[model samples]
Target: MDVSKEAKESLLVLDKQDGNKVKAVSGIDDAGKLKTVPPRKEHEQDFLKIDKHSNILENFFSNFMRQVKDPTHFEFFKIKTDDVEKVAPVIETMATQKDTASQEMLNEYRVEPSDYHKEQQGYKPIDESRIDWDNLKQFGITREGLEKSNSLEPMLNYQKSPGLHRISATFDNVKVDTDARLAFRETEDGRIALAVHGVRKQPELDRPYFGNNFSAEDKHNLLTTGNLGRVLDMKLPNQEKPIPVFLSVDKLTNELVSVRADKIRIPNEIKGVTLDENQKAELRSGKAVLLDGMTAKSGKEFSAEVQVNADKRGIEFKFPENQRQTQRQENGSEFKIPQKLGGVELSDKQQNSLKDGGTIYIEGLTDRKGQQYNAYVKVNDKEQKLDFYRWNPDKAKEITPDNKSKTQVEVNSNGKTNEATKEQKEPLKQGQTQADEPQQQQNKPRGMKM
Candidate 1:
């Protein structure tokens, strides 16, 4: 009784008895519209007041089926892929019960691709578990090596790893080092096999990026800072007009990353004071702006400069310490770099390297909760401060939201499965990471996309 209002096509109920032969009571007519047979003599009274646009649940359908006198009739309904989960159960109960009708209904709908889609070549996903992980031992690599370097997941998903890797292998009786990434390809024998990406000497930046032509300055900005520093209009394939995008470079791989600029929603207020249109525009343009009368997390007065950073794909604070001159970053003649961070003492050599704008891996850095974790640290020489990243920023830039690996277990690409509703005969709605249910028996339709 509770169905989505978006439901359009109702189930085509077919019932007839001809002794072991399946009698067709409804089918597609000459005009391609659904044609259902007229109700029999026993149900004529209920059909008299029913109109084409009527929702028959309240009275007509409720009373009409009980009048059928067929002793051994069977029912079948052609349900659509989307509406099956919502309307099928009601049909099942009514069709099977002896007091309701003299028959049972078998769901005839199965979830295979439509004929038009299957006629052409279709992509079939491979099960990664069937792969032989020990095959990489020849190259002195193991499954653990691929897992640690973030390459295993992509290969399992039939994609190339985002960044290149250095591995030692032998060829022509000579051992040499090679830089490459991993992928999976379907063999002629229909088995998933390992593939290695051939490397180019450099990235091909000559081609247009989403229909946006690159200038000399644009190339320079990307090469120097890894960010384009501003949004640009970019037209994607099949799109009529260009959309605004924040562009950056994956430094390790040199692949360009473009995120939709308009998707970023800036809050009306930050800390305490509301920002005007001018300040918001400055942030969107990737320019830093200083704001006063703001508050810090410790309930103290603070003021800082904030700007949009493409690498992080969000707003970041530049001079957030507290009550300090926000313009000091511009003139750091008297500013000094720290010798230690988060109470972890640095050796003189490491401190000097940080002062010289070098990145170093640091461990034993304590958080507010007293938990210690390792991090990559670099000197923000212009800001006279240190910056920390959980992963090396050079390699991490390639792991964007658009390029993230979909979790291996889920079958539906557009939507997720919910484990709470796993046993139900319904499809998952959207954004669920777990399946609606597991298939305990073979060849049973779990109502989930396989």
Candidate 2:
């Protein structure tokens, strides 16, 4: 009998039932006799594993379930009046896309203290949306004939020393004067802050408005409504897109001081190198190109040089020294090197440096066809541009092995790296091994030996 090793090593086996109960046979001994072992009881096996913590946990769940089963033990909480008052306008606003302004609106526009107090006391509350526009004239607010208020003034403000973290601001003359200045600093939690000098105390005002455009009449309307705030936008060099900036105001001084310009969008595509009309049209929107070729020795004197232009950077690479035979497969046409060829990449620090205006050097990039090249990529934040150049030994800095590490070329922020594995083919030998020798055919075994 042919038995598997696992079957022979099994501790117990089930035997044929003599009546209702099955017999348990222990493993075969050296003499080949089966010994009987008794079956385990439920409490003996399960209760031994239970501990004090498990008992406590079981009792806790049992008590919770028992209490929940009692209808009289139910509990709930009452909703507050203020919360209901707040939620009504939000629901109304969603149903009808108009400002209901609820009680919070009056608070934001700084309604008279007496009126606010009456509203909070649950008496009559003011509703801004319900107010008539014609009655606004009675309150001394004119859209057309309103002149510029001397109450507001502008000043050039700087943070730390002069020239850094600087921006122009408009302040209320009744509170902050032309000599007044404000400085803003960002906290570790990513909040903008304000500090004021040359004022008795900060003015009482609402939060500043962060917007792109506001006419003179718009300013008048906002100021009259007690809704005055800051406005800011940035137009960067070489790019037509204007990014919106958020600013904070000193409520006590009524001075607009700080703006945090954090969100700058780089175009998904930009103007780069173009070859054909199709390529040119694609590149005008900032598309990248994949180059193919191999490194080879040129001339009878055998000077090694890379034949292909792998990137937009104008760098030429040589064979063997910069690139090695790293793999055998090709991922795509752009990745023209064999799977075995090793290439360089940008380090983590180098990538971060690029975002802040720095260059990353890459070398020893070989295509599947055994071509090699070097590249230099420049990062410019102001232009929102990344410029690529071919590696030039004469003009560019020579990268040492320690300075350059292997990385895939990043086409764009959202684009994945054209990465590949490094598995090279061993050169074929001219001679054969003993395994290749043919063996004499032996006569078929006349049957298995007993």
Candidate 3:
């Protein structure tokens, strides 16, 4: 018996809440990947005639969806049995087509939309004779610029532009900055369809972003190098269970997005450039790296600067030639200064001291050897990341010590105290060598806050 030919894909359903439409589901506990699928009982076959009517069925599902009128997110919702019930009849028709010879298909996308929904949300026809070009003018993207980039045709069509675009549109009215993909998806209904893929902010450790939760270790590794370092089982929006995924920071948007562990297909040769292990690791970490000597589909060799964008949820090619002008524009803008390092949040005094670009000795970091160690850490503004060193650099000033931990390690392990710090009544921390201010000034006397 040939197991490969006999194996079948378990039934996959469109889940409004399953992993937010980025991926699909199989059995009850099947997280993004299909492991074990309990075979459907014999009676269930009558419920679905899967191998037929793909196009017309697409029209039915779209009409059914609008008639129900569920004002919900079509993206990023976890699929549940109840959620699957809404579209199962039409979707079941696609099953035999879905169950392929291989088990590698994981992220199942939407069925091809019907012309009704594609035109105007299943109820109206679109008028494409006139475009409100004022929308593009505010963003500094002229028709000439858009036409030059070959984005106008797709925008005129129902789908969005193929790649994520950098736009300076006024989102907050005060700020015209967001990484979004443009579409004419809802034009017939008088709506602007933009999939906002990225946002501006440092990944905050104190809270959750979207539905993805981060552990102390995940936070530390992400903030330092922008990579989660390992695969994490994270529960997404509307998902009842967690799925295994690798979390990466979008270097351009600073937005957090994850790639399904099984779906992470790193091509052996990207364009014509073959990447080794080190290059792959760098890309996985969400760093913008440059790869040279690649062949484009146009049969031309070119070099590209690339990084993982939250919009694509995969590796995206960035043109290398424009990097210098982009860097110059970005150089004057300071990157957000992170508040925590290795899972420890900085104190006001500690943070204030770093205002002038100083180093602070932080402990509790585990090295690759699994041993706890301490090091001087500071923001490397030039590289736009954290810099760690065993010894302090000459140009960096020292951050003030926290008063709470001051007395914890004042005395040496052998019970001898440092004469300079012994004279101070406030005591000294293990990492601190001197006292610079009075302790009373550090507090505002807030009630029950600590």
TM-score for each model: 0.32, 0.16, 0.29
Better of 2 and 3 by TM-score: 3
Candidate 3 Cα deviation (angstroms), residue 72: 38
| Candidate no. 1 TM-score | 0.32
Error of 1 at 216 (Å): 4.4
lDDT of 1 at 18: 30
Point out the worst 10-residue segment of candidate 2 by lDDT: 327-336
Clashes of 3: 10
Candidate 3 or 1, higher lDDT = 1
In order, how many clashes per candidate?
Answer: 5, 31, 10
The candidates, ranked best first by lDDT, are: 1, 3, 2
The order by descending TM-score is: 1, 3, 2
Residue-level lDDT tens digits of model 1 in 1-450 = 323332233333434443222211233334433334333333222222211123332232322333334412444343442444454455544444566233323322311112112111244455867777676677656778678656687677666665565556788777756556667788999776767654555545678877777788777777765667678888878888888877866444555766688756554455544577798887687556788876553334556776565544566555644423433332232335556665698889887666555667776655432434456776544433456665565567422111112221122221233444334333322233333445324335558543
Cα-lDDT of candidate 2: 0.29
Off by over 4 Å in 2: 1-342, 367-369, 379-386, 390-450
Model 1: lDDT of residue 208: 81
For model 3, residues 1-450, the per-residue Cα lDDT tens digits are: 432232222223343444322222222222322222222333232222221212223343344445534424232111222333444443434433445622212223232223113334533333544555676577655667556556677666544454446666556445655455555555567665544455456766567745556688778877765666666677667898777776766554566767776555553335535566678776665555688876543344566666654435556665444453343233221444456654578777767555546667777644322334466776554334455665565454443223333323323211224544444444344455544356434532457532
Cα shift from native, residue 166, model 1 (Å): 3.6
Give the alpha-carbon lDDT of every model: 0.51, 0.29, 0.48
